[model samples]
Target: MKKRFARFKSGWSLNRIFHDVTGALFAPLLISLPVWADAQPIQTLTIMEYRAHLNSDQPTVRGMIKFADLVSEGSNGRLAVTVSGATVPGSPEDQIKALQEGGPHAPDMMLLVTPALRHVEPEFEIMDLPFVVHSDRQAHELLDGPVGRELMSRLESHGLVGLAWWENGFRQITTSGKSFIHATDLTDRPVRVIPEPAFVETFKALGATVVSLPYPQLYQALKSGRAEAQDNFASQILVGHLYDVQSTMTVTNHSYSAIAVVANSAVWRRLSVRDRNVLQHAAIEAGRYERDLIREQAKTDSAELAHHGMTVHSLSPTELARMEAMTEPVRQQFFRSYDPKILDLYRHQIGTRWITR
Candidate 1:
């Protein structure tokens, strides 16, 4: 027996024995190993994407499309976005609801006007106050500042994430028969206002019979003589072909119409940190693009309207002051409903002098 054991040990060396034992123990593990173990770990990540829907095909919607393109490029195919205009039918409120609830057809992001947002958060009405924001510069300053940031942050409670403030330019008046040369011109006139309380109150304060209507219905309303006058951005007037039905354009600049780029809160949270940053920066850049487009369009819209047989008029500084004064009660009524701190912040940002009351 000793002679047999010695011969076996000499033939089976320690290294060979250890190797055979390890191979037997690890044979299943080696076979069961994932394919990734033999190759480089997956360098290609799954692409993340989202969809955006805007209320109209205005400059803001174009900007949203630009934003989608930017997010895709900025994220290097890690994130993608697709944008469509006026995909949802009905009022802006309906669009907002679709944004709040997510689905296959519902949008992950939306470009909502400030007035529509007022229905969700009344503090948004501060941005819709007439003549409060004097120029594009003032509007940008206010919306890009602390007051605007606070207002945006407040949207979290409403299941929205305010990304940036785009614009519809300043609201101007268009009438079918008469030109708005003074605040009194709107008095007793049937003027179509957006379906927002502030708009209803502002027009009523100016002594006009306010007809609350959705934007899509305005041109037909005027053409059918159901409504005689309306206020909207010059781009909206040009795009909607309101000049075809309306005979006059008044550069009232009554309120700077701001469009908010908002994402659903749940959707926002689902994004990776890097992707959220990309989306946010893309939104801000696209908003700047939209504002520039609107402003440039404003410079020539009057001439275009004139070419279309619509006489365009501008309100004199004195007349604007008078109009603002006339709307003071409307402002006061809205002010009482706002958070004092937020109102004060807005007032402070716009300069106290601009606040008539």
Candidate 2:
């Protein structure tokens, strides 16, 4: 026994014994270290952005991309955003439906125009009303203030969470036959307007024979004489090559168009409060970037359109006033149809005197 004990002590010295004890004690912790390092798994989100023009320079598409980047970086890769464009099937309306359904195939978020949202919530039409918002600054004031918040809040009941208001710039008139010098110049012209009621009524009030055609069909319609004029943003005119078919562009700025960044309510609720906040802040920041891009592009587009041999005209103050007066009834009808509180909020933000009942 004495010989065996001496052999054991010689083989296992103090350092060896100490190292064995610590190694045994830390084995479980060392094995569990990886789990601790990845306590939170990364969440990947899908965003379906619909744009008639999906070019790399498209402001709204770029904005959506910026939003995705901001969300990913802000979350430190915890939230990953994958942006898919027109590749997603169906119209904007159909896409909204899919988003609401919420499945493996449904997108977590979508950017929808106000007109598309109008069917879900009619108050959305208020944004499309002619002459309601006169300038970019005024639009920003209305949307970034209480009026905008209230409008977005209405979507919550419909399983949507509105994050920010992006712009499509102001709508301008492009005509194939003649320059719209006076409100009456639009009279009896075959003008293509968005299928939205307000847009139809506004052009009708000016005496234009309004035609509602899908955006993709617009070029052919004008080319074939099926439609003579259309109202859209300068970017649309440039991107859609409307200048090729339409010879005149009038800077009507009749209506300010806004796109909403919305998320599926179910998806939004699943996110942590911290993650949601990150998305919200990112959306707003990216929206500002998009708006700046659109405004800058508008300035350049006018010159480009002129270069393309399309005459660009700015409506005289008198003609704009006449057009505004003609569309007043449409605005009133809208005011009467929607929630009074929303109307009041809009009036308050845009100046109560601007829209009197």
Candidate 3:
């Protein structure tokens, strides 16, 4: 019996049994690895997407497309974003809702140029006050500087996580019947304004009867004569082909409009920290690209407006000073309505003397 037990514990038999049991325990794990390993790294995720009347040829839309492309590349192909331009089912307000409530079941990111955010945060309209920014550089200084960062940081409470500011260039006035070399030319004439209160008030202050209209309807309004005058960035005026009806382009440079690229808070939280950093970096790079594109296009569109038979008029240095003077009342109104600290920080960063706040 002792001799038989010793043989059972010897090399080949014991080794064979141990190997068989080990294989049995790990067989399922080995077979299951390919299925687990081959799984998609990302199933569904927040993506930056836009659906606006902005033409693909327009700088804003071009910037948006480039932004999406950068994000996709930065994600190493794990992230995908789709950008759709030219009129959507609803107004900018509706798009914001879609992002907020996840109406389509998942809210992605958006590059919005509208002041609809005033509904969520009224202070946003302060940036839209007429003639607040004298040049694109000043706009950048305000946005990329302390003042802009503060405004952006305040957005966290408003359901929007502000990513970057994309320029839409300066808002210029164009009309079908007259050339507005002076603010008085707008007196009593109906001018279309965005559906924002500050815009409506500013135009009214400028002695025009303000007609609030959605952006998509502006070209039709001008053609149908519901409103004979409208204001937008030069690129939009050219892209919307409003020159067909509008006879004059006044380079009033009333308000320098900046679009905010934002993600809904809920959707933002869902991103892994690593992925979030990737998206934020991509957004900053896209913003830099947009700024350069706009500076070039602003010059190009001014020439194009003239080539299209629209008389392009720029505010003279004297007239620009007068226009700058008018902004004080608007800025004062803003401080009274919003917060003085905002305007104070703006003055501190850029110096109060450069801009007559």
Report the error of model 2 at residue 294, Å: 1.0
Better of 1 and 2 by lDDT: 2
Best by the lDDT measure: 2
lDDT per residue (tens digit) for residues 168-253 in model 2:
98999988877888988988989898887988999999999999876777898999998999999988887778888999999989
lDDT of 1 by residue, 61-110 (tens): 45755676677568764555543322445566776787788666666777
Error of 3 at 341 (Å): 3.1
State TM-scores per candidate. Answer: 0.81, 0.87, 0.81
Where model 1 places Cα greater than 4 Å from the true spot, the runs are 1-58, 354-357
Model 3 whole-model lDDT (C-alpha atoms): 0.68
* Residue 229 alpha-carbon offset, candidate 1, angstroms: 1.4
User: What's the best-to-worst order under lDDT?
Assistant: 2, 1, 3
Local distance difference test, per candidate?
A: 0.72, 0.79, 0.68
Q: Highest TM-score: which candidate? A: 2
Per-residue lDDT of 190-209 in model 3, one digit per residue for the tens?
Answer: 89998787788788777888
Q: Which pairs of residues clash in candidate 3, taking residues 3 or more apart in a chain or in different chains?
A: none
